[model samples]
Target: MPRSLAARIVQDPSDGFRHLPHLHTQAPDLHVSFDVLGGGRIRARMAGPAVPALRGTEHKADLGARPDEVHGASARLCARWKERFVDFQPVDDQGRALRDRQRPFATVADLTAAPEHELRAVVADLVRGGASLLFDTLLRGDDVQTAVFRSYLRSALSQQGLRIRFDSDLHLPWPMLCVAADPSAGKASLDTLFARFLGHRHQIEHTGDAYAWIGTPRTTQSQPVVSLNHDVRVGRTTKADAVAKVLADGTLCTVRTTYEELIRDFEQPHLDEQLMYFWCHGEFVGNAPEPPVLAIRLTDGTPFDGHTVRELRADYRHSSFRPLVLLNACYAGLAGASADRSFLSRMLIEHGAQGVLGPLIAMPQAFAAEYALEFITRYLRADANAGRITHDLARHFAAQYRNPLAFTYGLHGGMDAQLERANGGEA
Candidate 1:
């Protein structure tokens, strides 16, 4: 099964060498094209074996929409349940029992103990509500793109891995947009969208060779105090530990912690790691004239703003090294508006990474760690490529966990790309 979608441009620095080893035997199953025109206007088109080509179906993105409006709907929906739960009173008798089961919770830890179904209900509402906004806002009134997107949803629901290639001036986080059918309200329902597809399972890859596999873990916190957000035990170390164990057992890669160390390491010739994984903090610092810079921290807790990121990528772009980066950082993959373009993500794509994956919003540490572990483990053990492995793992994780966090991660690149394994064999 095809397990991922890829987006790239003809001007990609990696150029001819971006094709993966596994793709040598076959032709691409899908192709998506994007045209960025004068005055910030952008247009997109999707065609594949599963799609019926239609005339005049090219869809244009509304770059004119207020930056806030373009990405606001989904962000608000995600927070709706979290904020509403406090004031929500269960009207039915069962709602009381549900509340009791979830009571005595002052902190996130206490919240985590709530019944899975109860939590799922809240998330489902978010998914359904958010899907409508996405369809209307991002799909931008194009019947063809909407129809093709619906087919993609159905394919994902059927457990068939997806391999889509998108070419666009502006990167759209396709996975963040939800689509589901709702018969009762005469609109899409939450149930259908919630069951649409697991997010982490899909890989957004790029068409290129991996420079090398590298993992950087920033396990310790910058501040000494334990706040509610910080107190939530995230698998920061657990994710790093798991990857380290696997790599140490024979994966060809390097793991670094400090910013200085990582910078020095990359300056050397041996730092040509293709798969770059970072377990650190990511921030979206909004400013004028520069869009929003994604601020990622080093081991020493220093910040690397978007400009710095662009510079680093330029260095790599000029060299023979190109990487596929995975950021376990918050907001690194946040679906942003045209006004607040995803600086880090775009920087990476422009620099030469075949693809990049990161959470759209802040994700639970424990859950993120577990999810990474699952994706990495499968990537190593299965014959499927990275995208397929992600799809399968996400499917299992969503089925078992039932949390929407799994869907928050966004893929920006060739989700269909593959790499060699530590065992010196392609998986």
Candidate 2:
């Protein structure tokens, strides 16, 4: 892929290896933790070399948001954010997002299409607003010098090479979280509102629960298997078809249009696949008594959740069942209030999957299809890592169409994962 627009504008020369583990010591690292309480309250804190400890009276605020109230932020129901939320159709896994945050709800009609500038404004709002949901309370004057200091300092200190992780059970779209930026700081194109998102500035991750292999990890290189949703439409210029073309042209892996076939393979102790892509409907499933778990369905509506894999898969040997799962479904990236880890992601990680990339909100099918096409194309290249691929996609969409939905997708481990092309192998 060509240099990203933001990278080109800033003249920041970056490579796929920027997020490698060895280079982390030269710069600062950040770790933020959040503990969810009985109510919608969160007990949050942060620590890093860049974060200083203050010895004074701490001013803390009782900040709590009802899960239902926060739903309005993504709803089409006439409310404060409805105007901007209308641009991209969003769905919820809860299946309970109300029509309006306020009574006598209003609805917004699409204005043909939102202009780039208007879209960027919404991007800034969503990023900064999402950040505020978590950090605004973490920021009262005493707790923070400025909201920017907490979210942007460590990243700005290291520039584009950021080694940061958000250790929280609540999988609030971490990349979409942004702090306020000075508008008059620079006149460069890279300084546009689009560049202010956390994902655009850093190599990010969540719940760094890594498993160590009990034995020597296998070093063999075999052709990977690329699996797509069984329901992908095949025609000219179709996103799923285009993504299939990517695999076909590269001879990347053994491709299959699978649904139950995947379930059957995953039930075994060892599945010989490197990358698994799902382009089906996904949502959170649960009643109030039980915590919501994210789940996906193929054409047959077979429920594929963490529990499904745990019960079906045989064992967790280092050589078995490990693959990078691209869950191109809505809300697959979201985790509930339990610190256990992501529903699907944690299960995949625990089951030896390298990493999982998915969306945090209800993403439209068209965007998900297009996103899969672009992401899969880059995934086949040896020079791009998962983190860079996702972040770069955010920049690409923002620059090309001012769409910020790409940032809604979060990286669960495997930020540094790079795949060898089936034909070319590693560079």
Candidate 3:
């Protein structure tokens, strides 16, 4: 990590920490409640320094009952997004482009040279579509929830370190929900309002857990793990090289070739890695009616998903180390509209992954590669907190490529997660 691009951009002379309030801290915390009322009903509630009144709202949405409708709406939304915003040739989870790759424009050169208006158009379209889906469909008729959330924002006094812990089953894209949007004001995305909205299965009793560990693990010096499944088709080899270059030395102890091997390696003694990175393709398997399972590629080019990962995770359930997993897989960050814990991201969390950074939908290999390089490079060079690193990488890529797909990647863990490598970690 000889002061790479991300390092040079983010590192400072005084301290490695950049001290962006939004990225560095999780302050002015708000408690959000979304309880299951049985029969596809949900009760949304809010409380904090912002919501002293302690109010809540209820809504009806049964993913199991209306699976087709929910799935169809999601598909339509994603399709429209792709049609409007995708500029570069995007490969599916198998690294195959839906259309011919040799077209008017496909490479990174074409992407960088694309006009600013084109980028702005993509952002504008994304904001509009995302806002419509969130408000008109997801939060429909839930005026109290919106009003309470707005009040929470007002009470924060524009502080950027707002952390709203969502304890609900409605896997809503809380990060994308717009607080305020004015095209003339250049405020298109809601990411600027808060660092992140923490989510989980149950309530968070203490604020300290949101940033730092509430209880110490038995092992503190355990090295992190990097599992880069081999995939020459989509240029994953280069991506893996980038990660290995950064996490060199003994900072990364277990660099496995396959998912099974990675799990086996972790089973060995003195191999409790605190952090793990997965670089491969991921997709949703299974048809409608039954929720889709997240399928990810292995070193042998075989794909495995949430069910397989969950089985392996059980092997480490009693282990003290709760690793932070970085998933470069497409749809690795997506959560369906249900309480079901089958999605890859949620499954990892349930299986003791401290948190996960992944994409909410399918991602372009080029974009995913660049984002990974930037994130790992910054993390190694600046030692910035993981949440901050995610936001920074997405923001930097969005600005550089004028691609709103950067917003697809998000931090799904404690807002205060900081991943520090062993003494000699280099990117």
Q: Measured by C-alpha RMSD in angstroms, how accurate is candidate 2?
A: 11.6
Residue lDDT tens for model 3, 1-427? 4764643456547443443324434542566554555665645455566445533532223222233344345455555555655544446689887574532122341255554444554555555555555445544454555554544534442344445565554454545444333444234333331222221111121111222322234344445454444443555434556665665544655556676775576454344555667777776677778866777786576666666666665565545656667788876766444434236666666655667777766666666777777776665454666666665554555455544565566566644555544464422
Q: Candidate 1 vs candidate 3: which has greater lDDT? A: 3
TM-score of each: 0.69, 0.70, 0.70
Against the reference, the lDDT scores of all candidates come to 0.51, 0.58, 0.53
Give one digit per residue, the lDDT tens place, for model 2 in 318-398.
554556789877677753345322677777777677679987665656567678878887887655777778878887776
User: What's model 2's overall lDDT?
Assistant: 0.58
Clashing residue pairs found in predicted model 2: none
Lowest-sum lDDT 10-residue window in model 2: 103-112
Q: Which ranges in model 1 have alpha carbons more than 4 Å from their true place?
A: 1-42, 55-68, 77-117, 140-160, 183-193, 197-240, 286-289, 313-318, 339-341, 421-424
Q: lDDT, candidate 1, residue 392?
A: 60
Ordered from best to worst lDDT, the candidate numbers read 2, 3, 1
State the TM-score for model 3: 0.70
